[model samples]
Target chain A: MAPLIGVVEFPGTNCERDVAHVLEILGGRAEILWHGESSVKGADAIVIPGGFAHGDYLRAGAIARFSPVMTAVAEFARGGGPVLGICNGFQVLTEAGLLPGALHKNSGLRFLCQEVALEVVGTDNIIGSRLEPGRVLHIPINHFEGSYVCSHDTLRNITESGQIVLRYVDNPNGSVGSIAAVANIEGNVVGMMPHPERASDVLLGSTDGIDVLGSLIDCLAGDTEPTPVDQGH
Target chain B: MRFDVKVEVRPRAGIADPEGATVGKALRALGFEGVGDSTTVHVGKLIEFDLEAPDVPTARDRVDAMCHTLLTNPVIEDYSFEVIPADSGSGD
Candidate 1:
């Protein structure tokens, strides 16, 4: 069966359609799950795409974490279902306690919107399973609060466990250890600041994200060693 | 009884506060005297809320829950609150 990927939609979410479209293009069925709802429609995988949910009022992802659908997302992740969060979604994940640490305003106090180079630092998780460690991916990140911060103990724990999945090649936002993406200790739930869905097409300037998205689908299909996607420059 | 609460949330020690740093830099650029390089500012949020509770302890507990669940991110922020009787004009 084709994997059913659910894209969550909050009131102010703007990237749900982009994620749904990209998932379909990658041979998966896509559905948009509403934030007010408390269920996930039995999706095989979940993607929380980027946007200023709830206007990022209290803080990025602070209010969104209380959305009704997030309870379902957390439950889904706890059941070992594949879950991916991008940009604003990443913030939501951390706020929801599905991931450790919190994202803060950029060190330069600027809302960065540009392509950044990322290195695959972890390969044990679903998102990085098929990609080679040290592979450079050029993906775009658009966010004001994207710098990830964590306690020293938490950093040491994640580093030792190989939970840090992606690292910024240029350290764009002052993330600790240059972390651009991370997974739960279980490696089933992943959160990343860079927009892999936005980078999935070559016409969009790079196809580097195909590997990330494809790896997700493969993991959902119960394939642990899926073939790597072509890394088109 | 009605209670007034003031919740202050700030980044924890050892965390970088870019917004605060930016404001401090601007203060120096604007020629604010005595704003030395050794001085640093940490910006934070002040949230005020009014609630009805039977007593001060109950009000404090409720406000504490609010800080833990919504007003602050414990991972990066530290929060404290003051609760006072709404009908009182001064401190206890």
Candidate 2:
């Protein structure tokens, strides 16, 4: 049986289908889990896909963080289950305290949508474990508040602890340290600005996303689980 | 008793404030006095809410929790608050 992946969709989340399609194609079964769901429906992994949750009214990911589904995501992460949050989903993760730091406005104060080259920096994560370190991958980023912000202490900790997973080659959005993705201390949960779903197929212009998503699929399928030392930290 | 609460949120010092910078630039372009390249500005949020609490201290504490939990992201922002009885003035 294909590992079931839960794709969480808040009211304004528009990428659930896209993410689900990609997951299904990647050898995982995807189930669209609504924000109101109190449980993750017994899925093996959870994904919070990109979109303007709650219209981004209070702030990106602010209101959505309060949704009941987040409770399950938090529990799953705590239990060492894999969880991935992309784009606005990343915003929601930080808002819910599942991930450190916050996503602020692009330093240029403009919405950005473009392809960016991401250099794999931390392989201690589910998504990064499948890729070679220092490898650059082409992925598309679409967001307004994708710049990562954290205190100096948080930066130092994540840097020393290998919590940073991906970085933009050109520092496109003024993210601190050019960080494009971050993982939790346990390395079970990761939040990334780039949309790996959008880069899943070569027909979509790039297959680099396969390496990212494929890494997670490998973990879900029981093909890979690296010890802390093997994570290459 | 009901209290009217106002919470102000701002990015912490040293954090980038591009929105505030853009506003500052606009002000300078409009020829506002005392505004210059060195004039540092940071835009923040003002959130007002009505709370039910027994007393002033209780109301303040509740608002503080709200700021910590939702109104602000402590990792990147700081917040302050003002509280008044809901009926103290005309908000109707």
Candidate 3:
């Protein structure tokens, strides 16, 4: 059966349709779930695409964290469901505490819009399984607060545990060690600053993001590869 | 009442925060290299205030409330304030 992927949409969120469209192109039936919804009833996986939820009034994702939909996403992730967060969605994940660290403003204090090169570092998660370490992929990023920061010890642990799935090649946000993406301890959830959904098709620019999303489809299809965690330094 | 308020802002981690790093480099260039060991130096604005209130505690409480609701982004920033008596216009 084709995977039923749900995309959550908040009031200020603008990327829901784009993500949903991408999922359809990738052979999955994508549905947009309103933020007030309580459950992922028919979702095999979920994607929280990028957007300025809540006008970024309270530290980007802070306000959106309290939305009713998050509770459902949290529960879904806890149940071993695959979840992916891109850009603002990444911010929301951190705000919801589904993932660690927070996405803060760009160090330059400017809203950045450009394609970034990311190096895959962890593959245990569904998003990482399709790409090899050192492989460079290009994805567009449009955000003011995209920095990923955490305590030194937590950063160390994330690195040691192979949870740092993506790293910006140019260190765009001054994130600790250019960490662009990370997965939860269970590897079922991932939050990344680059927008993979935006680049799934060649007409959009780069198809590198397809590999990342394709991994999700593979995961839903029960392509159970024992992608063991790598303690990459 | 006199209240002391400070606004602290730091760059989010792993961002190519050129502004913060530039400032750090500027500090080192100015011979304050000891500041290195640090990439970002948080910037803050201190707002001291004197408010006429029934009591010092009341003034402090009001000021603290103002800070959270208006003075800073509580999600990304933390703040603290102290209240003291404001001296009358000293023209001596």
Candidate 4:
């Protein structure tokens, strides 16, 4: 059976179809789960795609964290299921306490939409399992509030625990440690600001994103154990 | 009893407030001599809502919960609220 991936949709979410399309192209079944619904329908994996949920009012993802479906999503993540949050979804994960750190407005106070380079820093998580450390990939980021921030103590903890999964090559948003993505302590839940789904196709100017998404699919196929690319850090 | 609540939410101290800094820059650019270079600005949200509660204590408790749960994000923001009788005059 094809692995089923559930794409959650909030009121202002506009990336559900894009995510669903990409999953289907990757030979995985995708389902759109409405925010008003309380269940995830037994999905093999879940992807919370990017978009301006709740019009991004009161901060991005702040309002959407209370959606009925989020309860189930949290439950699914707590049970060790693979959950990927992209862009605004990343904000939602932090707002929901699934991930650490908070996303503030970009340091430049302007909306940034362009291709940015990312360095895979850790492969102990499901998202980076198939990629090599120090490898750079170009992915598009579009958001006004995408600067990740956390306390010094939290930063030290994340670094020591190998929870820092990806880092920005150029540090466009002034995130602490130039962090671009992170995984929860359990490593099953990952949240990133770049749109991997948008870059999965060759015609989209790059296919580098496929490796990340492919690793997710691989994890869903019962290959989720940590594969440390390099133990010297 | 009907009570009016005004909630003010702002980014916690030590966190960079880009929006507020932009506004401060704009103010300085407009030739506002009173705006000093050392001035720091913090931008936030003000939400006003009216609800029925038994008394002032209950209204404060409910509004505090509302702020914690939805009105403000505890991770990046701090919030405070003022509860008053709905029919009270604006002067008070």
Candidate 5:
């Protein structure tokens, strides 16, 4: 049976379907889960795609973090289920305290809408585990507030724990340590500023996202685990 | 009793505030007196509302809770608020 992947959609989220389309193309059953819905509908894995949830009113992902669906999502994540957050979804996870660090306005003070070069630094997370270390990926990042910031203590912790999943090759958005993605200690919940779904088709540009989403499917099928092999960064 | 509550939210001390830096630079370029080259300027938020509470402490406590939860992101921002009785004719 194909793995059932739940794509969560908050009110202002615009990338749910795009993420779902990519997952479906990768041989997983994609289901759209509304933010209002409290349950994940028995999904084997969950995804929070990017967009301005709750119109980013109080702050990006501030109000959306309180939505009922997030409660269920947190519960699923606590059980070690795989969860991925992209762009604005990453903001929500931080506001909800599911992930560490907060994303602030880009230092350039302008919205960036371009593809960036990323290097896989640590394979501690499910997505990074699927790809080889030091591999370069081209992903699109479209956001005004994509700069990542955290306390120095948190930075040291993430570095020592190997929770950093990805880093920018050129540090476009001022993310600390040039980090582009991160995961928890267990490597089950991961968040990234880039939009992997937007890189699905070769006609559009790149298809590097297939491997990222495919890794989630493999984890759901119990075909993969947290491999502690050092990437020797 | 009604209380007029005003809340101010700003980026934390060490957080990088590019918006603030940009405004400070613009002010310096415009030759504003007393606005030095290194003067710090920050753009923050102000929220005001009318609340019904029995006493000053009650109103203050309510607004404080709001600041801790919704009005500020503790990870990057800090907040302060003041509560004044609405009927004193100093609602500003």
Candidate 6:
């Protein structure tokens, strides 16, 4: 059976359609779920696409945390369902408390839009399960508030538990430990500042993201071993 | 009554503060030795308040509520305020 992936859409979620299109291209039945919805039933996996959820007012993801759809996302994640948050969606996840830490203004204090090289640091969760530890891939990141911040003890625990998913090679946003992404303790929930959906196509200057997204799909299907390209860093 | 509110927000630890560092360097160039030691902190809005409530205590409560609910992000920011009697510091 084709995997059913839910693409959640908030009011200003600009990447929902692009992510949905990519999932469809990858052989998943991608459904658009509105922010007012309350469940991710029938979904093998779910995605929170990137965008300025609420005009970034009063803080980037602050307002979107109260959306009805997030209530369902939280529930879905708690159930061990595979959930991925990209860019702005990543911010939303932290604000919703589904993920620890927070995304603060970029250190440069500029809205950066560029391709970044990321190294997969941990592979215990669904998102990282398909990728070998230490594998480097290029993904585009466009955000002003992409830096990851957390307490020292919390960072140590996440790192020791293999919850740290991705780290930027150049520390584009001044994230702690160059942390570009992380998953929950269970690994079912992942949030990343880079836009994997944007780089899923080869014509878009890189097909590197395809393998990452494909690995995510494979994980949802219960696969655990890292793919060939993902082997050896 | 007049109220003075100061909100100080800084990048959390491990987060870079290039803006603050840059200003510190500039201050040194300008020969302001003490200012050179200042780390970059983004402080915003020195808000002055004039309340219409019946009493100072009542007005203070309203302003405090406003600060919590809208004036600042409680999770990332810390605020301090001085609620001074309208004529306490200045002779009428």
DockQ of each: 0.86, 0.83, 0.20, 0.74, 0.84, 0.27
Worst lDDT 10-window in candidate 6 chain A: A224-233
**Steric overlap count per candidate:** 0, 0, 13, 0, 0, 2
Question: What is candidate 5's lDDT per residue for B2-46, written digit by digit as tens?
Answer: 988999998888888889988988887888878744327888899
Candidate 4 shows a clash count of: 0
True contacts kept of each: 0.91, 0.91, 0.27, 0.64, 0.77, 0.23
Q: What TM-scores do the predictions have?
A: 0.94, 0.93, 0.75, 0.93, 0.94, 0.80
Write one digit per residue (lDDT tens) for candidate 4, span A127-170: 87679999999989988888999988899999999999999999
Better of 2 and 6 by DockQ: 2
| Candidate 6 C-alpha lDDT tens digits along A135-187 | 89899999998988887788999989988999999998789899999999998
| Candidate 1 chain A least-lDDT 10 residues | A224-233
Residue A204 in model 2: lDDT: 82
Model 4 chain A: ten consecutive residues of lowest lDDT:
A224-233
Candidate 4 CAPRI assessment class: medium
For model 1, the superposed segments whose C-alpha errors exceed 4 Å read A223-233, B36-39, B90-92
- Give the alpha carbon lDDT tens digit for every residue of A1-233 in model 2: 77888999998999999989887777788999999999999988899999999999878998998999999888988999999999999999999999999999999988999999999989888897578879999999999999999989999999999999999999988999999999999888999999998987768888888778778887877733431211110
Shift in Å, residue A94, candidate 2: 0.9
Assess the local accuracy of residue A153 in candidate 6 as a C-alpha lDDT between 0 and 100.
Answer: 84
Q: Arrange candidates by lDDT, highest first: which order?
A: 1, 2, 4, 5, 3, 6
How large is the i-RMS for each model, in angstroms?
0.7, 0.7, 4.9, 1.1, 0.6, 3.0
Judge candidate 4 at residue B46 and give its lDDT. 92
Candidate 1: residue A138 Cα off by (Å): 0.7
CA deviation > 4 Å runs, candidate 5: A223-233, B37-39, B89-92
lDDT of each: 0.88, 0.88, 0.78, 0.87, 0.86, 0.77
RMSD of each: 2.6, 4.2, 7.1, 4.3, 4.2, 5.0
The digit string of per-residue lDDT tens for model 3 on B5-92 reads 3433443343344566666777878897458544555544466545677677788678777765555543345566666555545564
lDDT of 1 by residue, A111-159 (tens): 9999999999888887875699989999999999999999999999999
What is the C-alpha local distance difference test score of candidate 3? 0.78
